[model samples]
Target: MMSQKLAASCHCGSVKFTVELSEGGFDTIRRCNCSFCRMRGAVVVSAPLTGITVLEGQERLTEYRFNTQQAVHFFCSVCGIYTFHQRRSNPEQYGVNVACIEGISPFDFASVDVTDGVHHPSDGSSGGVVGRLLYRPVEKDK
Candidate 1:
């Protein structure tokens, strides 16, 4: 597998950054039909919460939540760019919009697993999303 670190940023470029992607290969990413997700036209760059780090713009981010409110959407307040969202289904997972990534582009949605956020509420808790992701290998890379 090819290990690579991807750089991503907001539309205005005020929020500059980088992400160390999983080398095993990352998913093609998915587009949601949910109310909020659909409108934003965002794609998810997932990794465990611990794996993701905001390289900059810590103060420029604005968070928004509604309804079950487990999902927290992070946006660049200055540019009004919805860069990523904390999945309600899995609080431990982050769904960063692939479109915002500076270096890479996700072109295949058919290959990615589609997560139905709209109907997740029926799943009881987590609305079907995983709670606090824990993704790592048993062995360390040396």
Candidate 2:
């Protein structure tokens, strides 16, 4: 309410996160009907990737990506909390869980345009990712 920083955690509180957000962007929930989302019951309220910051316990998290690993899903490895993910559709956008963050409720659900993830896997052309070897010298680290 008074504080702008939204604190969030897994159901067991093994993992915690904070979002430094602008005044109007906070919401109750966001979601899509894609097979993965439907199964997980995830609602994503997205922001610029730079907006959210993992305050502590980066090592306690796990990543998951399907079809393409570009959209990295970061969750609490201990408690299995679905915190956030890199948007495969818009890799530049940070897909955050609306329920994960503390404070804020659902924005206007009627205006929240849902995407048909069932048809389209992602917005990227081919989920192209460059290898580090392309940039690094051809030598393994000692």
Candidate 3:
């Protein structure tokens, strides 16, 4: 799989960054069912920790953590939009929000696998996909 570099920013454009996606690239996109994730509801793609660089507005970013506090979520303080997160499942990788990436949207995928974050693998449970989110577009009559 080839890696791709993408530009990303918060809704308000207060935070800007560049991300070099992991080898799996868009294939790594997924949704988590954790408390925070369920509320934020952002589709994410994987990138190595070193693959992301803050291009601007680093001071406008804020960190959020909860539960085990292993995963560090980053968002723009101005727009309050989640930009990326250090994955608890894989500390070496960050989950970059697809919505924040240029030319990408969560609706682009027809079906996205939802990870069972409620029963996290780090908690000694077999964390597998519990369900999938499907996007169906209605066609307009001519």
What TM-score should be assigned to candidate 1? 0.73
Candidate 3 on 6-70: residue-level lDDT in tens? 89999999999999999878999999999888999999999999889999999999999998989
List candidate 2 segments past 4 Å from native: 1-4, 21-24, 27-29, 104-113, 121-142
Worst 10 residues of 1 by lDDT: 128-137
lDDT comparing candidate 3 with the true structure: 0.93
- lDDT by candidate, in order shown: 0.67, 0.64, 0.93
Residue 15, candidate 1: alpha-carbon lDDT: 75
Best-first order by TM-score: 3, 1, 2
lDDT of 2 by residue, 20-123 (tens): 54334644234666667778766667666666767777788888888756778888988787888877777876777776767543332434445566555465
Extract clashing residue pairs from model 1.
Answer: 89-129, 89-130, 90-129, 90-130, 92-132, 92-133
**C-alpha TM-scores of all predictions:** 0.73, 0.69, 0.97
Global lDDT for candidate 2?
Answer: 0.64
lDDT of 2 at 93: 68
lDDT of 1: 0.67
lDDT of 1 at 37: 72
Error of 3 at 59 (Å): 0.6
Tens-digit per-residue lDDT, 1-142, candidate 1: 3345677888887776665554334553555656887577666767556655678887998999977778898899899998777777668767777878775555533344445667675366334332222224366788
